[model samples]
Target: MTFLGVFAWSPVSSATVTTTLGVDPGAWNVWRNRRLTPAPLSRTWFRRASGSPLVYQVSDVLVWLATKRGEHIDPLTTWRLSLARDFGTETSDPVEIRRLAVLYARAVGPVIGGVRFTTAGFQAYLASLLSSS
Candidate 1:
């Protein structure tokens, strides 16, 4: 989904930053396979070391949900599911969980604007989500 327009002014110039947050199906597929595919003998290592699996899985589910519902799922829900899967049952408070999710989306939205995808970017995104609240 598209974000509300943001305005920034400098002494010499000004610019508006508008970010759209959504996964492009083809790009996401390529990124998911390339980044989430574990080494044949190191699946456990990969899962333990990174949140790529959670991100990949949640992205798929979000895509499905969006298609089935015929509307874009907000970033907050996307972040919430990813956080829940990555953290398991450790974080169970609905209010706190949503607050954390919203914080994550706010912190990471600018970094992940547009249609770009990268493993490092995804990891950083997860870091922001995990570190919040």
Candidate 2:
């Protein structure tokens, strides 16, 4: 079920979700591993191939963000909304999303949950997550 006309039924990388939400990769990892984040479609829709990256339902992510707003989570909620506001709720351009990620990341500083989340760190994480695919 697609909402906001973004990813629809498509698979979204963890890095795309993390960068789009402006959250540190480590926090994202923790959230998913702890079940704080919604389960990805990969969990039941189909078996992911041995080396493919896990994918999430964009609608699930949006709903989770909308309801999880709090002191620590508010900033991420803001970034999620900002993408809709700045580029329309339907916007899903990777280039623009990454551009906005850079802008927002700089303003907030690259540290969250005590992890130093530089662009390099993000790129590295993305590489690692995608490398096996």
Candidate 3:
């Protein structure tokens, strides 16, 4: 099952499903944990694996995200999408998608992998995701 030319294991509920690509469960599960966790979602093991602050501008993907608009995301959700944008991936064809993916991952990787998220942080992230615009 797929949609929007993006491959997925099954069709997504239009209002809920954001991701199109079918990713390995291991990573997504980790992502989900962080996404749902409150800010400061566990900071012990992932610290070493963490990288520098996400490079939002370097990737073409980031630029694309700047243009995109969506219902504001809770911080974790916002962070999740951002991370995927930067690090998750893109179909290896068009230059545009690739670029967008990079930017997103950079925005998201820290909270998803590095920081610990709390419920309050989640709300803040969501507030941001849902643009006042």
- List the pairs of residues colliding in candidate 1: none
Report the candidate with higher TM-score, 1 versus 2: 2
List the candidates' TM-scores in order: 0.27, 0.42, 0.21
Worst window of 10 by summed lDDT in candidate 1: 7-16
Per-residue lDDT of model 1, residues 1-133, tens digit only: 2123221000000011101234454554565468532112112212232323222222333344476569865434554555655445346565666556546555554333222235554445445445433
lDDT tens digits, residue span 12-92, model 3: 121112233244545544654675311222222222323321211111222223334443333233333433553484343
Write the number of the candidate with greater lDDT, choosing between 2 and 3: 2
User: Is 1 or 2 the stronger prediction by lDDT?
Assistant: 2
Give me the overall lDDT of model 1: 0.37
Q: Measured by TM-score, how close is model 2 to the native structure? A: 0.42
Candidates sorted on TM-score, descending = 2, 1, 3
Give candidate 2's error at residue 3 in angstroms.
11
CA error at residue 18 for candidate 2, angstroms = 0.5
Off by over 4 Å in 1: 1-79, 87-89, 113-133
What is the Å distance of residue 99 in model 3 from its true position?
Answer: 22
User: Candidate 2's residue-wise lDDT over 1-133, tens digit each?
Assistant: 1233232222365666787788897998898899999676433323334444456645457667766764243223344455676547544555445455455434444342223334664444333322211
